[model samples]
Target: MTAYEAPALVISECQQGLLDPPPGAFSGLAAQAAGRGLIERTAELARAFRSRSLPVVHCTIVHRADQKGMLPNSYLGKMAIEERMMVEGTRDVQIPAELGPEPTDLVSSRATGLTAFYGTDLDAMLRLQRVRTLVVAGISTNVALPGLALEAVNRGYDVVLAEDCTAGTTAEDHRYMVDNLLAMLTRITPAADVIGRLPG
Candidate 1:
């Protein structure tokens, strides 16, 4: 595929939830992505994109805007009183060291929605690179995954969620989001399929 045709991979936040925290298929918020297996899965995807010289983007949520701007009018909004939970310069919100590509492998967010582009420069960055397709894999599908899928669809991009490369806060939310996207926004491809496409 040409650079224009090369698919880009995006890994959204697999960080610890403010309340639930990351769990190990194992336990704990310390390794949200690591615990769910996405950490390793995404590493492989990242390696492939890197080897192929494809554009790879990382997104994290750290509500820099007001609650109304970030969340709906509900308890969840009230709960997330602080902004910048995963801001660029925060000690509590660093990407796992196990994941690679160096410090250069991060894109900071100033809002708290699924689509990192909601209030950030994500779309601009991807647009600048002429990326029209996206492969998203991460934790919290119900939140980030859906948000990304919706946003990508609205922006006219082909979005694929790498199943198994991501997991949600709950089985129902995960299933629902995937099903919802499949019905309307995007497609869900298994991680194995994505891995097989790597330039091995």
Candidate 2:
């Protein structure tokens, strides 16, 4: 079988809040990385995946204003209280404009912490679609990308980390995670390679 036949792309936390950080938000090295055009690269990959009729799954973080779905005292709650981000029904929680999801795309959202599979049914959804390979990308490579990669492996899915499509708080942080921890679990490849392998 072709490498991409049973593949599904999972984009985690590529929301407006991260792509376009609000004033005084966590716009550190990660923001600088995104500013360097990671978002555009990711969007292009998403478009390519859709063109091949592959499943494009967007995993986001959405929480209520009253913290109804939040894990109390968790990092998510602290970020929500501090950065004031990802509140449900707000622009912060929406995926950015660049990688706009089509009506046929699958959107998985959680109200709590990192790892899209935790409070979401992303694994089951992908399995239901007969997806055995996962192409993962998105914000904070130090956080969500690695977390989701491990989870996908535990659930018996082969994962490919989109090296160019992910960003972290710093260049070192991004490189270290992919080269160290994540590299041990999945193949760290450029998005271009993955896209090129898809059938026309």
lDDT of 2 at 139: 78
lDDT of 1 by residue, 53-163 (tens): 777777766655334465545444444554323443544345565554454454746555545677788888888878877888775565667777788888988887788
lDDT of each: 0.64, 0.82
lDDT of 2 by residue, 22-132 (tens): 666757744755665878888899999898888999999888677775554676567686665788888888877777778879999887766799978887899898998
**After superposing candidate 2, which stretches have Cα over 4 Å from the reference?**
72-76
TM-score of each: 0.76, 0.92
- Model 2 steric clash total: 0
Which 10-residue span in candidate 1 carries the lowest summed lDDT? 22-31
- State the lDDT at 197 in candidate 1: 58
| Alpha-carbon shift of residue 96 in model 1 (angstroms) | 0.9
What CA RMSD would you report for each candidate? Answer: 4.4, 1.9
Q: Which candidate ranks first by lDDT, i.e. highest?
A: 2
lDDT of 2 at 115: 76
